[model samples]
Target: MVLLEMSIVPLGQGESVSQYVARCVEIIERSGLSYELHAMGTIVEGELGQVLDLMRQCIEEVAKSANRVTCTAKIDYRQGVTGGIRSKVASVREKLGRVAGPN
Candidate 1:
């Protein structure tokens, strides 16, 4: 499985680009892939090819409206592993819960 974290920014679309971001989220949602949307980017988990293709679609879709677009991505791949989108976070939280400290 592949876990990809991506952020698509459409240039010259003013200070706020939530509208474009929303479109990208729409595409991700429709892809039926497990994903998590965070403040800085969205993380999607799927086959490597499908995930890359999805990112391409998002970039092209945003380019249709914006003059220029920028995409930042981080990818993790592990053979025979899956569901990292949620499991990864859960693993961290599980470890954090073991810590004897204040929140």
Candidate 2:
């Protein structure tokens, strides 16, 4: 599995871009892939192709509504690991001797 942290922004969409963010989140949700939305970006877990395709979809959708769009993505892939979205965080908290909060 692959873990991808992605942020899609529609440029010149005024100061608040919550609506655009919401639209991207909606696309991610519809993909049926496991995902978590954070303040700066969203993390999604799936195969590399699936995740990349989803990212493309978001960019395409946002471009239709804005003059320009910017997207950033960071991907992590482990040879034999899955569920890094939650497990990666849990691993860190465990080493710190603390239980993870809501995943």
Candidate 3:
């Protein structure tokens, strides 16, 4: 599975962008992909094409409102691997012998 971190910034919208960000997230969720909303961006887990397509959809949705939009994404494509969003962080927490809080 490919792990994607996406942050969409809608330029000229306003100081607060939560509403626009939420719209982009909705597009991703509708794709039925596994994802996590974070403080700065969203983490998505799926196949490479799925993630890329979702990114395109998100950008399109955001563009409907704002003329200038920035879609920043980082993809981790691991063959024969999955659950990177949680597992990657968990691995570090484990190495530190830390117990995570309830999700």
The local distance difference test score of each candidate is: 0.90, 0.90, 0.88
Candidate 3 structure quality by residue, lDDT tens digits, 1-103:
9999999988998889899889988888788899999899998999998998888888888899989999888989999988888888888888888886444
lDDT by residue for model 2 (1-103), tens: 8999999888888878778888989999999999998999999999999999999999998899998999989999877898788888899989989988964
In candidate 2, position 101 carries an lDDT of 94
* Per-residue lDDT of candidate 1, residues 15-51 (tens digit): 8988888999999999999888889999999999999
- Estimate the lDDT of model 2: 0.90
Residue 17 lDDT, candidate 1, scale 0-100? 81
TM-score of every candidate relative to the true structure: 0.89, 0.94, 0.93
Which residue runs does candidate 1 get wrong by more than 4 Å? 98-103
Model 3: lowest-lDDT 10 consecutive positions: 94-103
RMSD in Å for all candidates:
3.0, 1.3, 1.4
- Evaluated with lDDT, which candidate comes out highest? 2
Report clashes for each candidate as comma-separated counts. Answer: 0, 0, 0
Colliding residue pairs in candidate 3? none
Query: For candidate 3, what is the TM-score?
Result: 0.93
lDDT of 1 at 92: 79
| Model 2 misplacement above 4 A | none
